[model samples]
Target: MKNKNVINYFKQVHADKVEYNKQMARLKELPSDYQVVYKEVQKFLWEFTAGDGMDMLPPMLELLDFFEEGAANNIPVLQLVGEDVGSFAENTLHEMQAKTRINELKRKMNERIAKKISKE
Candidate 1:
C-alpha cells in the first residue's frame, strides 16, 4: 500500500508538471509584468505541489529576475517550463560557455589556417 501511494504521488507530480507547462505556455503568450507573472507562478506552484512551495520560491524568483533583466535589455528570455530554475540557469550558463569556447577555438584555427596560406 505504501509503495502504491508513492507511485501514485509521482504520477500526480508528472501530471501537474504537464499542466504547469501548458499554463506557462499560455502565460507567455499574454502581455504581463514581472509582479503579475511572479504571483501567477507562485500560485500555480502552491496549487500543484503537496509541500509549502517555499523551497521552490528562491529559484522561481531568480528566473523571474532573469526575465525582467532580459526584457530590459531587449533580449529574449528562454522559456523553460516545468524546470527547476537553479538547475536551468546553471545548465544554460554551462551551455553558453561551451559555445563561446567552441567559437574561440574555431577562430584560432581559422587564423592559423590563414597564416599558413599567407606563408605558402
Candidate 2:
C-alpha cells in the first residue's frame, strides 16, 4: 500500500518534469524579447530555491518532523521536501506556535495543581 503511494507520487512528479521540459523547450524557441522573460523567471526560481538563514531553518525542521512522524507510523518517504516552496516558513511558524501553546498549557496546569496541594 505504501509502495503504491510512493509510486503514484513519483508518477505525478515525473509528469511535472516532462511538462517543465516542454515549457523550457518552447521558451528556447521564443523570440529574443521573450527569452529575456524566461531568463528572469529562471533567476526568480534560483532565488526561491536558495533561500537564506531563517528561510533554510524551517524546511530543515519540517523535514525532521515529517521523518519522525513517518518513522513512527511505518510510512516510507514523507514526500514533503520539495512539495512545499512558497509556504515553508509560514507552516513551520504555525507549528512552532502550536508547540509553544501546548507547553504553556502544561505549565499552567502544573502550577494550579501545586497551589491546590499547598493549600490543603
Candidate 3:
C-alpha cells in the first residue's frame, strides 16, 4: 500500500513536469513578437524569485533568458534558442551543484537505512 502510494505520487509529479515541458516547447515556437511577452514574464519571474541568487535561475527561465538576449542582440526572432542561445554555464553550474547535494542526501539516507538493517 505504501509503495503504491509512493508510485502514484511520483507519477503525478512526473506527469506535471511533462505537461510543463510541453508548454515550454510550444512557447518556444512562437514568433518574435509573442516571444517578447514570454521573455518579459521570464524576467519578472527571475526578479520575483531571485532573492540574491542570480546564479540560481530555474532551467526553463534560463533558456528563456538566453532567447531574450539573442533577440536583444539582433538575432532573428524565429530562430530556435539553441541555435542562437548563449551559454547557460552559470545556471548549469548552480543546478548541478543543487543536484549533487540532493544525490548526496539520498546516498546518505540509503547508507543509514542499510546500517539500520544490518544492525537489526
Cα lDDT of model 1 by residue, 1-120, tens digit: 999999998897777676556545644643365345455555544443334333343345455556666566754333423235445444443433222333556788999999999999
Give candidate 3 regions above 4 Å deviation.
Answer: 27-57, 65-91, 95-97, 101-120
Q: Using lDDT as the measure, what is the rank order of every candidate, best first?
A: 3, 1, 2
lDDT of 3 by residue, 46-118 (tens): 4423323332234555555656576657776445333322233334334433234345567889999999999
Model 1: which ten-residue window has the lowest total lDDT? Answer: 93-102
Q: State the local distance difference test value for candidate 3.
A: 0.54
Best by TM-score: 2
Q: What C-alpha RMSD separates each model from the true structure? A: 15.3, 18.0, 10.9
Against the hidden true structure, what lDDT does model 2 obtain? 0.48
Local distance difference test scores for all models: 0.52, 0.48, 0.54
TM-score of each: 0.33, 0.36, 0.33
| lDDT: worst 10-residue window of model 3 | 81-90
What TM-score would you give candidate 2 relative to the actual structure?
0.36
